[model samples]
Target: MSSFKREFTKLYNDSPANYIKAKRLEKAAELLQASDNRITDIALDCGFNDLANFTKSFRDKYNVTPSNYRLKSR
Candidate 1:
């Protein structure tokens, strides 16, 4: 597992966990823009089990909350 993590980080410049989190947030952003789903539901759909954590991660990545992002995107 450590070897795989090293290889993935070396190739992608980010750890596997970071990569997965980014992908999930990316998908959540897409869903926020494209769907009428509620924020909690979207978070769950994007593999975020906890809404608060998801919101924090999303905010950290985008510098805006999910609802704000959706509003701006639309």
Candidate 2:
């Protein structure tokens, strides 16, 4: 596994919910920087099971939707 993947997995195992949120946001950040993948695709790839839950968690953590976060960065 990659160093990042291992570190993230460790973080995930140490605190599932916290790491879930963190990993999602990290991948969301990467997607924002790297690609134009849709929010739903990024959410699923980042381990979110549902768009609604992803949106809610993202909003709770970042205070914005994934799209809006990306836009703000741009």
Candidate 3:
């Protein structure tokens, strides 16, 4: 498992879990821009189970809250 982690990180330039989270956030961003889904629903659909955690992760990646991101994209 550790060897796989090392290899994954070396190849992707990011840890496995962090890379997955980044991909999820990218999907969430796409949904925010392309759909009228509620923020909570978007978060859950992207594999974020907790709203607060989702908000924080989204902010960390995009430098904006989900609500603010939706607002800005409109």
User: How high is each candidate's TM-score?
Assistant: 0.96, 0.70, 0.94
Quality of model 2 by C-alpha lDDT: 0.80
lDDT per residue (tens digit) for residues 5-71 in model 3: 9999999999999999999999999999999989899999999999999999999999999999999
> Where does the lowest 10-residue lDDT sum fall in candidate 3?
65-74
Backbone clashes, candidate 3: 0
- Write candidate 2's Cα lDDT for 1-74 as tens digits: 77777786686564455766777778877886688888889888888889998888888878888888888888
TM-score of 3: 0.94
lDDT of 2 at 58: 84
* CA deviation > 4 Å runs, candidate 3: none
After the best TM-score superposition of candidate 1, give how far the Cα of residue 23 lies from its true spot, in angstroms: 0.3
lDDT of each: 0.97, 0.80, 0.96
Can you rank all candidates by TM-score, best first?
A: 1, 3, 2
Off by over 4 Å in 1: none
lDDT of 3 at 20: 99
The collision pairs in model 2 are none
Per-candidate alpha-carbon RMSD to the true structure: 0.9, 6.2, 0.9
Spell out the clash pairs found in candidate 1: none
